[model samples]
Target: MNLKGVRTGIAAACAVVSLGAASSAAAQGQCSRDTLDDIAAKYVEGQKQGSIFTLPVGEWVDYRENGQLVSTATGVISQPSDFDWHLALVDTGTCHVLVHGVILKPVPYVVTTQLAWTFNGLGQIRSTVVREGDANFDAKKTYAYASKEDWSEIPAGKRDTRQALLALANAYLDRAGGGAADVALAPSCDRIDNGAYSTNCEPAPGAAFVDREFTVDEAKGAVAVVSNRGEAEGPQDSRIFRIEDGKIRHVHAVTPSQ
Candidate 1:
């Protein structure tokens, strides 16, 4: 998996390339969160059928697998696979959704995908990063843990601000890279990478990260950060966070096994 698309979502995604996720997201206020969820669900179904044409990839599409440009007509999405389960993050502010799936049939694989959509009735899939036997990866365990995780929507009044959420995300990355961050962690914070898991993590500054693009779901104190998108092959890296009361509750990731 090319972690380069890690930065791709925030930096060079389809429509967000020119306008940036922040600017364009405001202008595309008409983008429907429910629609995004529906599209993502469709993508999950499409993958099982080995058909990329199932989704509304409008006009011109820019598809990539592990940072290497791919001919959308014949790429990973065209290959049918069985997934144990999948997790989807809908970022209405950025008009992009991050889809993370774990496959357990034939050979096991974990895939992280990001899709860019516009109100013009066009949905463009910009990145599809696949990981096979990455570090600490155990597809079955991941599926089991994911099923128990609570990602329910945070009540509107109880939600953390986007800026706060973003900071927490950066902090997690910082700590991951061995830096000192001043973010809070819940008493029972959980961290999952591939299938290996940990608990009660500390926070740090995310400056160790570069070329980062963030997909934030303010409604749920969740953020998915994809960094180093410019690299074709590095680490298939991604960090997802859920924070409440300024303390991180969960951290999720997909990276190289070796």
Candidate 2:
């Protein structure tokens, strides 16, 4: 479940080494929000088939599971199952989409997975990073959060600019890691790890050091952060924030690093 970084495993490590030298200009095609949504939907369907071959993808699509690169051929797509996509954040500007969902397979156990899908302008999948949790997870708690209506798109007037959204996410990370953060957390800010209820949005520092990664989706007031702990590496975590009256009203996370 905690497989570490893409630079860890043998096979995945090799891909990382070579892909670093791969030119980005070749895949820098522009993409639209609708296109990203369609791609995400296709991914959900592919998960059920246990093979993502149906989707438009490059010859060598970079794939990572739990930060570590797995067998591109038979790793995640090998398991066919029913997928329930709970929350989706589309960052058209970045040509990326982050989806929080659960993979339910009758054979073994249900798993909670957060998928970060990146696409080239040509609408083909360029990279996919999945953070999968344990097999056994709480369904009730997950449904409660996933069923909430607050996750919908924030109204334009209430929406924070991309910069502000990024700052809030950064501040929350700082506060969680014992750093002096000027952040505002909702009164009922709730956090979830895997599929279990974790905390009620408290300003408590966590054990590991958190490095603010990229803002995966500032439009929906959501951002993704990674922990930089020694060689083991930290989890690829994402959080969704609900803003009201210019203050953070609620917070939700999937595999929150803290």
Candidate 3:
């Protein structure tokens, strides 16, 4: 699809995301990180094996890719891919995990997916990937920066609560989307997309962010930031963040070229 076509799709994909989590997930009770981590492993295995059934999913798992709601059976997860490597952001509070992987086969693709393990079962998955034609997409470069970055658990003393993490992330989107959002950045913070890297870390010149979704991992002080909609310019969608001691540290994003 062309760029405009991609933008149109994101506009439609915005309605159903529910900002990336189930409304009653907390009431339903959170799953242990270990359990969520296991489900994440199965998700990667599903990609490696190309079988959606590999997930212990609920009766109906809502799967949305690139802002379009599609069948899980025909989704990327069902497509067999040989990956160079994969990294996962596990969030226990909301029972969500965002998996970022670089696939080697079927024409290189950088896939960033967020799957929610709900009380009903493994439910809700949203994905945005940068393939060969995507703007600034260089799988090798993407892997180089993304893989080298550290997303390991934050020390207990330095960890921020889930609520704080969410606020910080939205603040980023505020600045990213062209609004005046007071966000902090560590001296080390860098925004990375596919294979491109930049220390400037600015979003589209005037493009706004909407249809946002977040997968916050308190343990690691990172959140998977998804601006489900696309922008006319600059990068938008699936910008993951790593925060430490009230500062933005690292960011990895998936979007069409700016």
Q: Give the whole-model CA lDDT for all candidates, comma-separated.
A: 0.67, 0.52, 0.72
Cα-based TM-score, every candidate? 0.78, 0.70, 0.81
User: Candidate 3 lDDT, tens digit per residue, 1-258?
Assistant: 111111111222232332233334435466778767877888888898977655655545567677676665677776888678787878766677888889867768898888867665555677887787888888888777777888888889889988888898888777776788888889867987677899866555445677676788888888887664445332447878888898888887788553
Clashes of each: 9, 6, 3
Supply the TM-score for candidate 1: 0.78
Across 1-258, the per-residue lDDT of candidate 1 in tens digits comes to: 222221222222443433343244447565568867876887888788877655655444567665456665466677787567877888877777888778887667777787776643234454535455455778788878876888878989999998889887876676666677666889989987787778846643233555577778887778887765224344436777878888888877765533
> Which residue pairs in candidate 3 collide?
135-257, 142-194, 142-195
The lowest-lDDT stretch of 10 consecutive residues in candidate 1 is 2-11
Q: lDDT: which is higher, 2 or 3? A: 3
RMSD of each: 6.6, 6.7, 7.4
Cα misplacement distance, residue 140 of candidate 2 (Å)? 4.1
Please write out the lDDT profile of model 2 over residues 1-258, one tens digit for every residue.
Answer: 233222222244444433432224336455557766775676667677877554444334545554556664566655786654456666766555555555543432223233333332122222222233443245545656556646666666766777777677677767766788877766666665445665466646764444434535544666544434322456544455655544566665544232
RMSD of 1: 6.6
RMSD of 2: 6.7
